[model samples]
Target: MPRLFTGLEISAQTGLMLSLLRGGLRGARWIDPENYHITLRFIGDVDDPTADEIADALARIRRDAVEIRVNGLGSFGNGKPHAVWARVEPNRALMELQGEQERILQRLRLPAERRKYIPHVTLARCRSATNQDVARWLSEHGGFQAPAFTAARFVLFSSRSSVGGGPYLVEEAYPLSVAGGLGDDFNADAFAGHDFG
Candidate 1:
């Protein structure tokens, strides 16, 4: 079995900027810069056959590349702060891509996501941080922004069954094209030389 998700890996430059936002907040377990990503759909633990089906289905997606921008910082929690993240600027292309993924997963008989999709690159996990602590941290780094970058592809990432963030493995990748077709050069192994960190 593998815990899977489809996501856009952050550029190294953007990851570096996000890494700087670490610390100050107590009980914050900062995620490694290499693990920063905007998740499209989280496909929880699945059998190997199901995972293969997911990969094959995802390979058929032909959406164009998306221009991603990291804008502002926010926390997710009802009362006690649970996590801090860098917000992904809203864009039609990004939404369409995620929506398509949602439909595909549901068609495969997977359960729908309970929470509304909010694009964000999680920066830290807050275990015992309070509302006051989160509010103060947000006040200090709320203006955080990163240069816009084009996401040429999305990847299928596998992570260990653990508590917090990654050591994620890029299992496969699918290129995005304006022409709505996979190019002949599309290689699943093309992620080899790239550094997600």
Candidate 2:
């Protein structure tokens, strides 16, 4: 069994910028920079056969690369404040990709996602942090932004049973055809050195 998800990996430069926003929030476990990603669909735990089906279905997506912009910061949880994340500017390409994934998963018999999709790159997980703590932290560092980057690929990532945010393995990869010369210089080597932790 594997816990699976499809997501776009953040570039090294963008990861570095997110790393600078790590501290100051007590009880918040900061996600390692290399682990930062914008999830398209979280498929949760799945058996081996199901995982294979997911991979096969995702490989059929023939979409073009999407331009992703990371801007501002916000936290999840209405009153409890469970996580802090970087906002991903909503764009049609992103929504279409995510929507396609949703439909594919549902067609494969997975339960439909109940919550509406909100694009974001989770930066940290908050355990004991309060609403006031999260608010103050947001107030101070909410202006965070990173240069726009083109996502040339989305990955099928798997994680073992553990606290979230980290050590995700790339089980499979799906490339997006580049429009013009947008992703001509992008290469997997830029994301290869880390230990996946």
Candidate 3:
């Protein structure tokens, strides 16, 4: 069994910003740039049948694409500072999408997430240390912001451990229809410079 999650990839520019932040932090494990994502739902380890069922459910979710912005940097926990992450600017679209995904899973009796949904993109993982370093980092970098962009789809990813570290393998994708297809006006230029595969 493998752990799975639904999330959207961060843009290249945003990824570069995260990489810079990682370099200055102490006691932090820099996350691979390719692994950066805003997680919607974590399905944990499940059997093949459950994975297939979840995939099927995800495909049935209907929503238009949305513009989400990545803004600010922060750390979690009071003393140890377990994690550092890029905060998502508050957007109803992101929250609604998260809620929809949760409802779909709950219908299948998947256990609820113990923690509340706080939209963020993990930048680093921290181990035993005072949060003083984290506090200073946040204060200095909190104003960081990325260009607002439309996320038209999400992926169901499988993480496999390797000699280097774990790499996220996208097992499936769920497309969001836009107005050109579902109420969103898309700019092909936004994707013109990128190679997804």
| Highest TM-score against the true fold, candidate | 2
User: Each candidate's TM vs. the true structure?
Assistant: 0.91, 0.92, 0.86
lDDT of 1 at 100: 96
The lowest-lDDT stretch of 10 consecutive residues in candidate 1 is 188-197
Cα lDDT tens digits for candidate 1, 1-197: 78899999887788999999999998899999989999999999998888888888888898898889999999998878899999999899999999999999999999999899999999999988889998999999999999988787899998998755999888888787735554333455665532222
Q: Specify the poorest-scoring 10-residue window by lDDT in model 3.
A: 188-197
Off by over 4 Å in 3: 161-165, 181-197
lDDT of 3 at 197: 26
Deviation in Å, model 3, residue 19 alpha carbon:
2.2
Could you tell me the lDDT of residue 51 within candidate 3? 82
Q: Put down candidate 3 lDDT per residue, 1-197, tens digits, no spaces.
A: 66678887676777787777666667777788878888899888777788888888888988877677988888789657988899887688788888999999999899988898998988877764468878877888888888786788777877753322248877777777665663243333333221112
* Model 1 clashes, total count: 0
lDDT of 2 by residue, 81-105 (tens): 9999999998999999999999999
Clashing pairs in 2: none
lDDT of each: 0.87, 0.88, 0.76
Task: Tell me the TM-score of model 1.
Answer: 0.91
Give the local distance difference test score of model 2.
0.88
